[model samples]
Target chain A: MSPVNLSNNKIKLSEVDQSMKWAGLLFIISATLWLLAGTALGMISSYKMHNSNFLANLEWLTFGRIRSAHLNAVIYGWCNNAIFAVGLWIMARLARTKVRHLGLLIIAGIFWNIAVTIGIIGILTGHMTSVEWLEIPTYITPLLAISYCLIGVWGIIVFRDRQSEHIYISQWYILGALFWFPWIYSVAQIMILFEPARGTVQSLTNWWFAHNFLGLWLTPMGLAAAYYFIPKVIGRPIHSYYLSFLGFWTLALFYSWAGVHHLIGGPVPAWAVSLGITASVMMVIPVLVAAINHHMTVLGHFREVIESPTLRFVVFGALSYTLVSFIGSTMSLRSVNEISHFTHLTVGHAHHGVYAFFTMIMFGSIYFILPRLIHREWPSKILITCHFWFAALGITIMIVALHVGGWLQGLAMNNPELLFIDVMKGTIPWLKARTVSGFFLAIAHIAFAINVFWIVLSVKNKPAVIGTKALFTSPHAK
Target chain B: MDWYYYILTGFVLAGLIFISAVYAFHWALKNGQLKDLEKGASSIFDDDEPLGEQTDYSLSKSNYNLHTTTANESSKFIQ
Candidate 1:
């Protein structure tokens, strides 16, 4: 064995980390700050749902604006920035190449954050486009799209000069996501906002864009992180090569069509809705294949899963992906959609996929990637532990409350005898529960931010402990 | 009339993605991209372990095997 030098190799190992340090750190810090802001906005919006007059007098804090602000902040500000950090780091490492255009990436990241900032402010100030996830105003969309191009092209360039002859599954997903996001964004923007699709067609385009944004952009990126981290941490390979390929190709083939299922009973053509249903059901193949592969690989490694912070978060995300995708497929059925559509169930379902699955996985990737980038160790395991528990419990409470409460609300609405006021009243308690859950999530975010800032502020406080057998061998190697 | 354009765009985009995927899959197959399935999976460990050394799968598998065998032997001895 090569003499493992904690002191000497630490400097050597960090050459890779130094290539990405500034851009990666900036993206992560920015993403965590947005997470805090989003958490606050989410809490306010949930409170307003329960008590309509909580901030009724404030025009800026109205439910519509606050909720839109929360979504944009988390999706654009938080998730996109995190992906820029985590995704690019993974691509560079896997390709065994240093990131070029570091300066451009930093500029693009700054511009991207600035665009999201202005976009959120625009939404709050009533320049909002009111187009679901695309509420980031017309002016800023172009800026974001341009900055994203500047940032995203680096991944492909890195791959072009890769030292590794074989492209790993993670690269395929990352490359695909980088290509897919701009196409979907531009198409949705042009059709829905610029030219303006007529009536229900606009709604179809909206759902199409919204759903695929999650499916293609966030889902694949999240899965890519999980695929890379799980095997690396466990010191084992994925279960089956064939299953991985099937999962990827089937996902690429079926996910785009599954978007139309969002407009199941709408004025859209029945043929279109039927196609959506078929495609949604077809999603089971990919989801199950991925689930089986992950589960079998980690089957005997439960001890590692419990010990490693990264593995814990990632395995939770992998499990939630399975759960959420299954629920989503069933919900697309006509009978299920009858009760679930136009209800809080869909809202809960969205949080399940985006928060529980994607966000948790992103958190995992950050934990594993950040230390390497900074050439240091996390200062506080207590903070990390607390953050995990708070987030897990918070999202769980929110999802359960929303789905069950929404079910009753849906049933009550279907009844001709029941007054609408009573149905609204019925959801108040659940919304209140959701508000409390938001506070838990807020605490989690604060803890995470503190942990990050503490490590960053004291970057050189601890000696470089990387390149040791202990830290690399086990997740519990603190 | 514009709605037809929207619908047509969707179909064309879908067809393009489908065709691209097929071509990529064929290319991968022809180039032996999928031959050593285990290699790519093990490559991620480069960050965790010593550089330039691919993880030995058979070694790890045998370790796991030894673990289970020890457990079985212990249980039998206890009985």
Candidate 2:
């Protein structure tokens, strides 16, 4: 708060950014490559859904393997890499500490990506484990765990060496996720893959791991970005510190328990199913708390949200978090899960959480962080706008088509009088719509990738040529 | 093979979460982290990236000058 402290803080912040530069750039660039790869595979998978013969000739491109590969590429490849770039940078900044041992971190990052590459290759090459989220082959799994441990440990070390006496809310979320991921990932690996749990316990553990990976690992990191950027961009504090505290703890407590709801209607016991359902429903408390906090902080910043690219993407993600979490809670109910479970609706819901909420927030964070990390402005505004609209519109169409088609499909299937062919026939149109939506997403990602590389390749310290107006000019300057 | 596998897995996972959560909460309370809600909320902002200042936007010639000035000033620290 003091003048000298402020100056010192600025220097510290710069130091933090400098420390993250090479490693952060490496993570982000790798993430972009994976994003393109994953999106292409996703398009192929979507097309195969409607027209099965599109890639029927290739054994590795078989629908099942391709779909699993796409999932891993996006999850482990794109999302994790982006998380490393954005999440770690944020952690370093909030902790007010310089990230030391950049070489180790970079090596960990490289190994993590290498492991993912090998895992995706293994999945496609008939070495997949057949487990839902653990499709990556058993041999490659330990490398991933080890690489992740190396990367995740850096976050903890940063926290341990933090200069700030009062821990910020973002730090809490990042720290919690840093700790939670390894525990869940390793446990899932040991129980479900390495040791091989018996019978239905395997399925139960599979769902537990898969859901917690999303809920605990990805969700927290995404929320951490949203919490930090929304307020930081608008130049305001979060609406209520108490609400953030409540949101975080509640999410931690309930989300881990809610994974079992995925096994409803399975061989899992009634009590376990009930516990999952209860936990899933109880998740509303945290979701609502976060929604209120985020929306309230951005209450009158509509103009800023429009002007600042970072605010725009982050705000969109923050809104989607509210929407997706509520939908997820609703879907967890026995009545709803019975309808939505196996239908394309669940697929839509997954994208709603992962792509719309988590991915969008990451996009926004990159927009903010890259400028500081690289000390170069984004090369083009048109590209950023193009990227936002395409991504936003694409995911919107995908979610609607899948949810509506899936609900209808679910309804028709439940009515046994309806012929099975009719149910399958009804889904083709929706699947085709999904394929169409994939094109929009593809274009969006392309635009984003172009902009990232453009800035990276552009001369540093050069003035931006795209727009003339300052989006975040000082109040006095205006 | 047995039902206790379920219980054991459940208890262990749940216990880890519970113990960790309690520890975090206790540490937070002891460190006075929960006391000053307002200050903690505003802790993210500083003079360089001060509150109410939109620091990032799509770059343009008009804003480019402003950005570069900040860049120049901040560049000193990097060296």
Candidate 3:
């Protein structure tokens, strides 16, 4: 694409109002800080694994602290807050409603940051919950829950007082996630912490909460962005309203029960595991529907996708959802989980969901919002393409390395007589490769941070240039 | 936790029902119920008037007096 100019098309200033700019700017600031925190911790975690004594003496910077810090910064500080802010802001714009109780949103943002701050402190001080994805201490969970409640409440208000009555497809996903997330979170907490539940209930609640975090909350947020950005970029209505609705309902129906599949081969009841397997398989229907709707609708307009970074990331994200769901269901099979469980394969599976699936959506959503929210186009299209390549390559290498390394480890462990060092030797190469490629990913993330910073801070409007280019266009202009 | 499982089982069951209802609503919509929902009430009101009922969803034409204003506007755009 040529030099991107900002003036010709005359941006919708009402869309880029002060409230939007402020909220967008704050989110960017939060994201950059979170990136720094997540990256530093990630590198430490990587290095300390191979060289155990690298940071062994530092109490606050131990591997566990860094891991929890990394997770919290990336998930809560970086990903969720940023997406929630952008999602709610965009919904307001599309619904043609002014932001309500602006002070409340700012206060909520403060509460959000405070909660993360305390969570990070607790994790570093060895006060973690020790549960994967529930590492934040009990004291901090209430704060995060309250902040989320406020944000969801604001969304309901904005959606309720809309200019138009016909609810858009995007609203369905966002609204579902907004309401459903609390149900999953609160129930899990109440059972796990406050009141002890009966036999197998803790594991059931744990898996239920963890699964819904992806299925109900993260997926909906991503899908909402998908439903909105896809049509907005393509400049066409969804191929079929019926199909979009079908995908929504099927996902809600099927995604919940599948959480139990994660506990396959564990002490969970037989019926529960079977139910999870059934639901996991049933998830294919919604996945297929959404895939066809997103991919087919953009089929004839391939050129636009090539030039547009937003579309590129979103398409990758949309495709990854299919791949991840497929992988998730397959891994749930008893025979498969027997080998893959407790192996790095599970790590690869997770990255497929988190980095490949959800983070891609976050990346795409940020790209789509930066221009509208900040009133400036990205500094350069080349940087955007470079960022995607590095990220895609990094995640690709990480997952493949882990999968292969894990299969070998699984084989070695099965021998029972094989030395643990033998398993380590086989996987060490991949772990090293993961560290190396992760550096590239770190750079890509920094590149993205820079791009975001420029968009939010730069205000001098330049001459507008046509920017109909899709993301993966050949760098022939090189 | 045992009691919680029972509650979760209820949640699971409720979620299934909710999703089914949403699908059913969409099925009705796909069958062209929502686009014509305005007619459900408007037709009742139109009965009192001498104008004909809205038999089709071709809002492109000002075929009825009750909707002549919207139909006429659409006709101008069609040109």
Candidate 4:
């Protein structure tokens, strides 16, 4: 047993839980700031895609720059870091310990924030490699990679001291993601930035990085959250531990090879694309198993909690994870790829993963964690419900519109008689719907930012009179 | 533009619906096997208490296993 550090807990705001608390709050800040920045960039890019005159004055607000910012802020700033905060908490609690180098981890948070600041700035300043996700240029990659390492090392430190000898399903995923990220990021950076492979192969490397960016960086983290929360919510051990192993093995085996499907019928080798399609198709098994396991476990007693804002968003997100993966596999088929690959369908697919799948889970985990961190519950159930609806409806409308628009464009482009403008004419209505949907989503995000800020501020002042709840029955009211 | 296209689209949509339905059925089964819940619910009344002390599954609030048997499994009634 490790020596008791009783002195650590007696300080002003508990150094023990500080590892979890500050890190989580930083994530809330990081995610919100990035979200605001990302949405601003997204709207910019969206506007530029159609109305190219929208931001012609500012070089930093150019389409290429805005696109990169949108991706980086949302991916790195919002989702991954937020998961890191929650993942650490879940890891610590399961380990029957807190982060050992708590102070260092907090310092690493400072480092991470600094790295993201510089990376985003670098992108805006025209310092991008333009390699899709690895867009922060050579100078920023090392900083981002180093920051991730610092965070990763602390995760390993937490995992080393576990009360439960058997690693939980969530732990397996967190550990995998922790280790997998460095290897993927370092290799992608080295191959794309330093070496600069030419032409078709460079495209290959780009696709490789893009695919693995989601698979290695995100899929593991999101699944880990789902694994922890789904079981935790229902208060049951996951339906079958064996199925968890099956899901993990298949995902690791197939998903890494599955990224090249994005380059189907392109300059990449036919063999590579075929393998990608095969791997993607095989992805169905793992995705289905995971979705079934998560859904089934939360079947009965928690039907009520599903209506509860937290579970509602999380489960919807979980369902989206399954849907997106399935959609991804099917789209990888050559027949489907012909129409969907370069269309708005692709945009829809991407959002299915990022916004629907990851964001929803993040929302659920935030709801689960806030009370624990601040010792106060959310002020109003109505606001939370409205937040869920706005996001849910907005995303639903946007995805549907994109898919329909993409299909129409694909059909028109394939036809011999139709001009490209005809396709544009058809897509105009869907894009209009998307802008409206974006407004709804943005409002929801702002509402979330306010709610979280309110909860944090209320901790020192008058705590909100949170309604009676089963799990969040906190006695240590602030 | 041909009969095959019609067949293909019909088959694809049907397959998708089937897949969705199967997915739902799996969810329902996992949540609670309806027959099992019905059986468990009914068993509460059909059987009287055993000749020993009563068992309270919820006794240990924190450590309680919700999946462990609460119903009188030996008889068709609830005790």
User: For every candidate, what share of the true interface contacts is present?
Assistant: 0.15, 0.41, 0.01, 0.00
The residue-by-residue lDDT of candidate 1 on A146-215, one tens digit each, is: 9999888877887776666677888888988988888788888988888887888888889889999999
Task: Quote each prediction's TM-score.
Answer: 0.90, 0.92, 0.82, 0.80
Model 4, range A1-478, lDDT digits (tens) per residue? 1111223222221233444777777766677777777877777787676677887899998888988988888887887678777787767755545457767777877777778878888899898766888777677667777878988998888888654334566776787677767766766676567765556766776787688878876888888888876655443345555677678767766777788998998987899989989999999989988888778755763543443455677788888998898888889999999988788889888888888988888887787676667555675555676788899999999899888888888878888899888877788888878877888888888888787887888745332232432224222222
**Better candidate number, 1 or 2, judged by DockQ:** 2
Q: For each candidate, what is the lDDT?
A: 0.80, 0.84, 0.69, 0.69
**Cα error, candidate 3, residue A162 (Å):** 1.1
Query: Of all true interface contacts, what fraction is found in model 3?
Result: 0.01
* TM-score for chain B of all predictions: 0.50, 0.63, 0.40, 0.39
True-structure Cα RMSD, model 4? 11.9
Error of 4 at A379 (Å): 2.4
What would the per-residue lDDT of candidate 3 be over residues A1-478, giving only the tens digit for each residue? Answer: 1111123322332443445666666766786678667877877887776778987998998987887788777878877776676678666754555566766766777788889889988999999886667778898899989988887888888777655335566776787787888778777776776674765777888888888888988887888787766655544445555677778878877887889988888898899999998998899898888888888756765655665576777778888888888888888888888888888788777777878877877787777665555444566565687788898888888888888888777778778888988887777887887788788788888888877776556665331322532121122211
**Cα lDDT over the full model 1:** 0.80
lDDT of 1 at A178: 86
Considering DockQ, which of the candidate structures 2 and 4 is the better prediction for this target? 2
Please identify model 1 stretches exceeding 4 Å from their true place: A1-14, A461-478, B1-15, B47-79
Off by over 4 Å in 2: A1-11, A460-478, B1-10, B59-79
lDDT of 2 by residue, A381-442 (tens): 78888999999999999999999999999988899899999899989999999999999999
Candidate 2 yields a Cα-based lDDT of 0.84
